[model samples]
Target: MLAVAWAASGDSHEVRLCVTDKRLVWLRDDAIADRVRALRLAEVDEVVARTGRVRRQGELRVRARTRRRRLRFGEIAPGPLRELAEALAQVLPAGAVRLPAA
Candidate 1:
């Protein structure tokens, strides 16, 4: 998912949320030649996906100690959001994920 990483220090950067068996990773991909994974899944302290206004608009946040990555619904649909949430839930610790209601 395409998102922006916001740090507690008031800095933000475009990031790509990538999930792997070992962990969830954040890749920096903003008009660059190559995409580099800047953060790993182990850095995720909490994760949540929220639905707003009829489940059409969704907001996903994967946060670490002092930074957060968010994916909005601008380029995402309901199906993708569901899939992303499910995928994230699988990688995250049990009972740590709260997907939106069906």
Candidate 2:
């Protein structure tokens, strides 16, 4: 994995957003073990990063051609997510990922 950040989604325990060479993976730690969902960089449609204010951390959303609903994680650290976005942009097609102006 290239980068990883603490992610929050509903009631899932130990949620994480991981950036890899070929894919973006969402890992959920359940009672049994870790469950993973991956989206290939080549198939990604868009990546949206929303910065948080004083009360919130941040949010990261990813959309892929194969998935109907966007994968969203809140309370994400902006630093790691920015790095992940940069890493993803290198592998994903042009215009596939979107990042807020710095």
Candidate 3:
């Protein structure tokens, strides 16, 4: 499964995406947290898990934005926790992934 998380505050935003086999969670910044919470309450995905809980066969994506910075995480692999960390490192905003110019 593929999941995306995005938050917008003022003029800046943060986004994250996670893909797994069972579940997905997306966390938004304070500015958009209400909307995100509402979506979660509405069960936007086939399955949803509360924040900070890790699932056995699922994925979790979180995004948070404040006033001056944006952060993102994507495609967390499952296996060893370290593997997930490595994957995150490769996909985070400062990582190897590159964005297309607009």
Candidate 4:
């Protein structure tokens, strides 16, 4: 899966998320550049989805156990963020599994 996230005000960084069977990569393109920054789902302790006050915009923060390590994707539209977060949770280790409400 691939998706983009950006601030509504267009002030923050824009990011593209690429989800694969073995990795979750974030890409950035600026001044003729393309590279994959791999931060695998297994490395993350949690992926959180947070809503901003205005509406339709939120944040996804990936927290790792390492010191001072975090990957934040903010100003995302809520629906896509939720889907991505849930997908991430499913792929995590068995001890950290998450199930959607039924």
Report the Cα RMSD per candidate: 6.0, 2.0, 13.5, 4.2
Error of 4 at 4 (Å): 6.7
Instruction: State which candidate has the highest lDDT.
Output: 2
Q: Where does candidate 3 have its weakest 10-residue lDDT segment?
A: 41-50
Candidates in order have lDDT scores of: 0.56, 0.77, 0.31, 0.60
Worst 10 residues of 2 by lDDT: 29-38
Off by over 4 Å in 3: 1-63, 66-79, 95-102
lDDT of 4 at 29: 47
What lDDT is reached at residue 9 by model 4? Answer: 19
lDDT (10s digit) by residue, model 4, range 1-102: 543344221222656765665677776643145444667665778666677776657777777776386667776777776676666666776545332222
**How many clashes in candidate 2?**
0
- Candidate 2 colliding pairs: none
Give one digit per residue, the lDDT tens place, for model 2 in 1-62: 78788888765746877888888888787625548777788778898887777845677788
* TM-scores for every candidate against the unseen true structure: 0.61, 0.82, 0.21, 0.70
Deviation in Å, model 1, residue 28 alpha carbon: 5.9
| Residue 45 lDDT in candidate 4 | 81
- Candidate 4 contains a number of clashing pairs equal to 0
